[model samples]
Target: MLSWPDELTTELRHDLFGWCELWSVPTLADEVTVAVSRRLTSSLGRANYRHQRVTLQHTLLHPMAAALLREVLCHELAHLAAYRLHGTKIRPHGREWKALLIAAQYPPNVTYAAESLPACFAVHKRFRRPPARRSSWARLTQWIAGIPCAVR
Candidate 1:
């Protein structure tokens, strides 16, 4: 039942929008859903391509550093970005993903040392990462902008 502060969600959304703009992709800002979950057992964050959602591990929020959270957020979002640009058949950490990470100003490291955090957060959970089709924050935002201002 852990949840993120509204301000944190705002910041994350802003970052996602910025990345979308950087890539010149179509967007509907509100479409890139962010969910908090305590169910994650091995990863701090995950991106679901089918639903255009990013799930953050709830337990990690309290004890994990903001920088770490930001990094993980960007990492998970990059997966979505890469998927949007490439088909689902592409490799998870393939060239397209690396390119997107570089463009997004992320370190492009496939694996992170989740052990740095305290035991309060289960940083070792194995979350699923899906390959993507063409849908992203940019496209979501653009689509939303065309309609009325919606937040969902």
Candidate 2:
């Protein structure tokens, strides 16, 4: 029972270890590491079996998204679980992985619904266009016409 980092709540740790135990791979917990990635904008989570690490999107850390966070965590953990149990020959989202997710009580869906994401983690809102800066050509034309440059 290694103490996980602050990002992993006690409940999450319990679920993670419990899954590993259920799969008869109790030592898997020690082999895996979980991390939060602010750079992960396009995806909710990623699992790297080669490195035995799971990287979750930073937004999932928000308390408002706790349920989603757990699901994504379980999703990634299932990847690791399948790899450990089945080796490299299995498809990434094949029956084995789906079964693991089902066994863990999560839907075996390959991807989450975008609308289900918390608004704070919306991609469009996070990277909003910076006030539509006037191009240099627009500014030059406005200067020649003695007109004030307005951002469009």
Candidate 3:
């Protein structure tokens, strides 16, 4: 089972507020519920219910630290922003998610590291061109596979 480090949680809260400032969305408290469950199959994190809540699976928290926390937070918050802006009408990782990610200062491509975890979990070193459309679950499955952790 995975659990968030105290420092990581603190930083995640700060960054979420920062994202709110950038996107012009209302600021949310660190009250975002994060759980590290073994049931998840993707290295990716999820923000469900229109940013009202979020969950970071245990495998997703492999190497914890400040930078890694920020990357994870941004990645999950990107999902929240996408859901909030487009709702169920838009694809989860489509254009809106990519735009919000870049706007939040992360590379457009969903990145993961192979060796020791990256300073930023999902921020790839290589720059990737933004996709034209929302990513389907199939694409997300592929993306998640690229992460070094085992997806249960």
lDDT of each: 0.54, 0.65, 0.52
Candidate 1 displacement at residue 152 in angstroms: 32
lDDT of 2 by residue, 20-103 (tens): 888777898878888887666545567877778888776567665688778878878887888889986787767897899889
Best by TM-score: 2
Backbone clashes in model 3, listed as residue pairs:
36-58, 94-134
* Top-lDDT candidate index: 2
Off by over 4 Å in 2: 1-3, 111-152
Question: What would the TM-scores of all predictions be?
Answer: 0.64, 0.70, 0.57
lDDT order of candidates, top first: 2, 1, 3
RMSD vs true structure, all candidates: 15.0, 13.5, 11.7
Alpha carbon lDDT of residue 48, candidate 2?
A: 77
Lowest lDDT sum, 10 consecutive residues, model 3, at 114-123
Off by over 4 Å in 3: 1-7, 27-31, 38-41, 59-66, 111-145, 148-152
Per-residue alpha-carbon lDDT of candidate 1 for residues 1-152, written as tens digits (9 for 90 to 100) = 22334646567667777876776554624457667665663445677778777777653355324665666566666667777777676766667867877887766655432232211212222223212452333322232233221111
TM-score of 2: 0.70
Stretches of model 1 off by over 4 angstroms after superposition = 1-9, 26-28, 111-152
